[model samples]
Target: MAERKAFHVAVVGATGAVGQQMLKTLEDRNFPISKLTVLSSARSAGKAVLFNGQEHIVQEATPDSFEGVDIALFSAGGNVSKELAPEAVKRGAIVVDNTSAFRMDENTPLVVPEVNEGDLHLHNGIIANPNCSTIQMVVALQPIFEKYGLNKVIVSTYQAVSGSGTQAVEELYEQTKAIINEESYEPKILPVKSDKKHYQIAFNAIPQIDKFEANGYTFEEMKMINETKKIMHLPELKVAATCVRLPVATGHSESVYFEVEQDGATVADIKALLKDAPGVVLQDDPDNQIYPMPADCVGKNDVFVGRIRQDLDEVKGFHMWVVSDNLLKGAAWNSVQIAESLIKIGLVK
Candidate 1:
């Protein structure tokens, strides 16, 4: 493989939680960088953030801020991406958006690098990263989707509060203390920040993760079901999800039941496939009580899969647990990985 000259890169929402992780991932990966511009909301502009031990000032992100950027990574929010992504594209920047604003767009490629890196070549100036939970799930499932053929999927997520934001993590800590001290506290954020109701996320599991759609699934659940189909390019694939926010702070875990098209696929077959799968760590040791867990997967970029077993009732069905850092593999690392794919495939100059 040959290396190309470093390209100019800009990160939109440089000061937010996921954005900070994106910057760190780019640094840790030693991504080629001729120039780096850190852009943020007006509220966070002018703040100084240390990157690779050097100070970089966050500037307000605007259409004009993308003038010379060859690649723009977006994670601020959907509204922000919806507004500025086109401008970035107009200025010759390839946008890797980490929001729902463009994930379902017919023209945009919804990618999970492990599952759909080839989708990068089809980008019309923008590529969409799948939802956090969806990214880790498909990474674990794609190998199966490829070898045996996937027929159906049912996932129940145990997502961490960090997926909500830094504030939700703060509220969880604050609420925990209030409870331990026998104090009273009102919940202000969790499940969904903008929803009409808020719930305690310290010791409780909130079954609803995002706003409810007319179809009765919360937005988060719909994101999983729909995005899974799109990423796997199996729109007719049957999928369902129930997303829940847990007290844990970083990783997202899922109990997934999937049925394959191939008959008589054994549990050992599934384990063997995942053991060598890309972006997946296999940890299925029941006798030793080894399995993937949120606390253990907090800082890792790889999705962890475990507790593999054949479903008793459904011969074609298998169940497994999948876990990954919502901040890293779920958002930042996935976004950065898409950018790297762009460079690797020569989609970006």
Candidate 2:
């Protein structure tokens, strides 16, 4: 028997929420790692991170950080990814970026492993992880698209506060506590932190996730729309999205309505198809009041799907609910899965 080779892995933004989850997912999966390097912004450098019960000190990320790294999972921010991802690639490392920096690039593959693992082969040393809300929705939709031939998709996301980052999550908690105690609290982070205005995100839903574009869609919504088309390889596919931030902390849920090209596809058929779908869990027993929800989906890697039914008005339209841990499947786990797929297909050695 031949010995399986372990590679040196580097995690950028090791101190952030998604970065922490990346390390945990790598450990939980027991990924073969000959060495692990945790990198972060200069402010977070020297912070201690524990991986597989061993403490690893985070270093300031620079062009030199990718030296000898085989796989680099990046989640710092778009600007950081823009600057460092190419550097990592230049250093002979394959980067799986969890930011929007490279997703829309014609040369880069926007990948959700279950949907477009094969796209890794065409990668120019970097792979873009789709938006968190897009990841879970597509995971649930891919099987349906494959079986019935999808034509159009409309998704409304109920995303978690954690998707905004740990600061937003903390703001939600602080505001909720203050509100419950009849105290006043100010909103600081949400609906686009850098935007001039911040809105309350506790016990309320913000209809915007990211900055709005000239086309009236938020960046987050546009991400879902564009990334879905790219991953499904359906450039002509019609897709629309409305992204909202809810008080939930970890999981992201989406109400997705899609139209299929094939006629006479029944609800029963969709259920059966998703029952065996890879990286998906079918929980569609509405009789018992079962469905995918954010609270119940925290910390899980698989996308949970439920509430599948045909639209009453349109013969080709069907609606379903999709849920998954935003930090895991949406960011960290997907990045790791991309690395795994690269190894499985011999793209990385």
Ten-residue segment with the worst summed lDDT in candidate 2? 184-193
After TM-score superposition, the amount by which residue 139's alpha carbon in candidate 1 deviates from its true location, in angstroms, is 0.6
Q: Write the per-residue lDDT of candidate 1 for residues 237-329, one digit (tens) a residue.
A: 999999988999899999999999998799999999999999999999999999999999977899999999999999999999999999999
Best by TM-score: 2
Clashes of 2: 0
In model 1, the runs with Cα more than 4 Å from the true position are 1-3
Error of 1 at 321 (Å): 0.4
Which is the leading candidate under lDDT?
2
Per-residue lDDT tens digits for candidate 2, residues 227-291, read 98999899999999999889898999899999999998999999999999999999889889999
Q: Which pairs of residues have clashing backbones in candidate 2? A: none
Question: Which segments of candidate 2 are over 4 A away from where they belong?
Answer: none
